[model samples]
Target chain A: MDLPFSTPAGPDARSAFEASVMRHLDAAYGLARWLARNEQDAEDVVQEAVLRAYRFFGGFRGGDARVWLLAIVRNTFYTLRAAAPAPSAHDAFDETLHGGEDGAPDPETLLARAADAERLRAALARLPAEYREVLVLREFEECSYKEIAAITQLKIGTVMSRLARARERLARCLLEPAAEASP
Target chain B: MNCEEARVLLHAYLDDELDAAASLAMAQHLAGCAGCTQRYRGHARLQQALRDPALRVSAPAALRARLAARLPAPQPAARAARRWPALAAALAAALALTVTLATWQTLRPRAPAGDALVAEAVSGHVRALLAEHLLDVPSSDQHTVKPWFDGRLDYAPQVKDLVAEGFPLAGGRLDVLDGRRVAALVYRRHRHVINLYQWPAADGETGTRERDGYRVVQWNEDGMHYLAVSDAAAADLDAFVRAFRGASAAGAEPAR
Candidate 1:
């Protein structure tokens, strides 16, 4: 085997790839977790994506592996969810659930940032699934309209519309509560 | 420009697909129309929000190493492992058609769950012990190790050498720890295997806890954190950790 796919990087590539993955993995995991809604299932999705990325890594066209991984993550979620047992959606185990009235700032980001920071992340965590994926891909993943189209298999226009709607939902989310509180 | 035109152009403008002239027109319209401008601003703010490097989630050390070890393929092995059971079942069924054979042995053997994740890291470390694929970037020097990982990994892992204390720097390898490729700086202390896994910390940022009877230490330094797992005594690990940290601080060659 050419070993193009095996991860043991040149004693050096290993650290680089690990760092890149860690930097991006949580966002990938968070998105996967939100969409899948179970810790084990989300981990399963990430592991599956990691494996797929490994096997066909020879085909990777190199610009920003994070973007590539994010694409794989979305694909992995749908693929695995289709094959696996479905979980009850939005069962609300945690006080700060996705799409709930309020969502927690992912502790990964919130732990280190300023006090006022988690507001947007908390708002983001509250977005409905349909809106969250688009926002995550377009916003955090930095995927182009075309890339989002390919990842979601939607028309470019649909990607655009959904992103605009995602932003609108977030804007509504951010503005509505503050307005209500201003009395 | 009308709402129809602005609506049509909003995406193109946000996506940077518009020509210079059309972009200018969109900007002019965006300046004149508050609602559309807010929409544009919403898109812009949301776009900026996504790019925040802070928003990127760090995969924990355990998860990253786990990912790295299996990066080329984790699930497929499970799929492949599934076949042995079917094969054994077929063999048993054929024997039963003739004269029933003991079906207990038909249960195919598979690697246990915990072993499965640690296989590559342990085996690779052991193999390096045997064959010496250790340390492409050789040097216990933190300066060397840090810069060695500069273009290699996303973050720098702490590297140190405690040769005086008996653990000599054998080498380092880029292996997946928790599925993310990370630095696995190898060391030798009288036959006990040591694997130090370093990757950015993520949502799984719970504190250091003992895993499967192994002494594991995790802590943050500068902007990154590291987790080192070894079957060796905690004192030895701490000595190594102290040496590593001290070396990193002194700007000397870290414990190899």
Candidate 2:
């Protein structure tokens, strides 16, 4: 059964909606940071989301403002991403160059430390934006299969399979480090 | 359940979209397939780890200051609507409030978490039973799965295939437990998913031991702790334990 999500946002509802968005400041910013991959750009996206949310605060149906705010953040991020150059200025760390892990407690003891976080960032920079985009959404955004679907406009199944393959390729990049170290 | 099927259902498995019959099937398969289990756990852990970095960067002072100065004190809905055309929706909502005193709650709807982690395990278990797609990365050769874990994590994880001998290696994945990332190897005998969550120990501490409704053999050795859980007949899981325990003790450390 399809039902409209909007209920009535009375005086109480409006205040509650604002408060609700306030609570999700961290979450919304977190998501923006993941997508933009830079603190500044992420902040820019968050700012845009907040403003848009304020502008349309009236249209908001009174259920789950957090989800609504996040949805807005998702929408706003792509718009900026399309206009923004090199998305890296946003400061999101792509883990490709680090080649995955090394050195923690001790070298061998540290299973998969991002000893190569820097290297990962560089390697990630070299990949096509398509691949980098998926990794950021799946890895950093941690958006659910459905959420990713909504954000990327891809089917849920596509999101999963794409993420799996992307990780596999990323793993390949990371694994080369071991081969380089050996012999 | 075969590896390909498990891969397809991995998302559904995580979302808990399958019904009871199917979930049980996957559980049975993951119980004994090492390859499938590792992929599942790894996907999950990676998802979690990737999000942690975004915890919170305290809105930069510059951004916060800019926001405070530019944004007006949110005008009272009534007053703002008159001054700013942009706040028409806020005005509309306020108007609706006065016209109808009906109580309505909208926003912050609770979610069903049963679809995520624990539910994923059950879904994985069930699908394996109905179909043979339990192992996506099929291999009796520990060499295959062991290598897959090479660049994935620090210590190569042990993925043993003992299904033919009554103790089947289901699959493996990277999982999180005890606040540390670990490997969860799946094994099975009949209709149980034996989740063997393993993580390299910090200083080399074997884990705890206890018998819940299920049989769990958890202990740390060399540098990793293994927690093997199952709903199979206790004795059968014991057989798997004996075989696994023996392998490590006998020095078949394929996970270099």
Candidate 3:
């Protein structure tokens, strides 16, 4: 990728770029951690993403550095995922079942019983990559529908529907003791 | 809005994604309707649960340092080239000539300097480990690791599989030393890491030194300066040096 303008070859410009990118390191790593699903893989993704961002720093037109950096992090994760290995069965989640009309248990009781972080994490992990990504971007990252749309390259309507479906699936996974008891 | 309409927009309502009119309608519906309000509360509870601090993971400290160390230094020449498109071609020719001349000059024989280079090598070794930036192109296979340096550096440093010698090849990375880019070949001896820094040698005799409890072994072979730095005992480092030199020598003859 080419930078629109020449980056001045000096410590000042270098540090400016570093500062802009570094501030979003947590956001980048956090998104990567959720997407990649492990610390080592997350580190690898972040490391590569950071380098790519630096290389393309010349092209960065100043705006929300966090969003800009996270976009690179997202792209890097996809690239690494594609190159690394074939997807396992567990990586795939059925979107049709995400819209199941099963009646949820009482919210208060379910919330109290399933408040454990491990259970929530496991449920989140079981989600299909697409649903999981939208959930994390909205619930975890607190990004708006427009921001999620921009990052994931989905329409705003799709972001809303996916997030709605993702939350429902997560709630089912967390609350349904039968699903947990099986395996 | 009725229950069906409210349910469809419940998530948007919970997320505050609705317009002012829609939001007002939803709020009115939630106040009057028990079921929708309960659903909204459930959504809020789920959001709270997901946002728990325990559920979030922070970037590790070493990872942050590793990324910082990997940031490329500013390339002033590239900026200069961009500003003068006409001069870029001429500048590229001059640069090629300068690199060629410098490579030739470095191949000539001279006594190797002590202290400064040793200190630099030792620091590079420590910085790489402490920052967790040990390898940029991590691989045990020489074939995989060697080709990674192509177009990344001016010269390709030899990557030898030393696993048979108890020092296995880890990977390689482009490092800056003495204000010039050099190839750093990484190898692992048990838990210890050895960084072999190589650049076009400036006619220097082989030497060894110890600083900060690390062994620094320096040698020049086939127009490249090889400095191996590690915390491993000097004897093990020496064995590495010998094995590395022998491997490179064996490979160099075929290329020549």
Per-residue lDDT of model 2, residues A58-152, tens digit only: 56656666667777887777766554334443234343423344311121212253334554454444444445556665555455666666666
- Cα lDDT, model 1, residue A44: 58
TM-score of candidate 1 on Cα atoms, chains taken together: 0.44
Candidate 1 regions with alpha-carbon error over 4 angstroms: A1-40, A58-68, A83-116, A178-183, B4-8, B49-54, B71-256
Candidate 2, residue A121: lDDT: 51
Best by TM-score: 3
Question: lDDT tens string, model 1, B1-256?
Answer: 7866676478679879677998999999988887777556555655566566665554456656766554322232233236433223222222232111111212325546444334334433433332223455666544455566664565667666567767777556665544455777766566465667666665324234453344566655666556666656778777767666665432443334
Count of residue pairs whose backbone atoms collide, per candidate: 30, 73, 1
Candidate with the greatest lDDT versus the true structure: 3
Query: How does each model score on lDDT?
Result: 0.56, 0.52, 0.72
Q: Higher-lDDT candidate among 2 and 3?
A: 3
Tens-digit lDDT track of model 3 for A10-49: 5775798878888888888889998888887788788867
**For model 3 chain B, where is the 10-residue window of minimal lDDT?**
B94-103
Cα lDDT of model 2 by residue, B53-171, tens digit: 43334556675555443233434444544654443343343334322211221232432442222332332232222112234344445556566555445566766657556765645
Window of ten residues with lowest summed lDDT in model 2 chain B: B99-108
Local error of candidate 1 at residue B93 (angstroms): 23
Per residue, candidate 3 scores C-alpha lDDT tens digits across B39-104 of 778878998888888877778999887776545345434543565343333333333333332333
The 10 consecutive residues of candidate 2 chain A with the worst lDDT sum are A102-111
Each model's Cα RMSD: 16.9, 27.4, 14.7
Model 2 has a DockQ score of 0.07
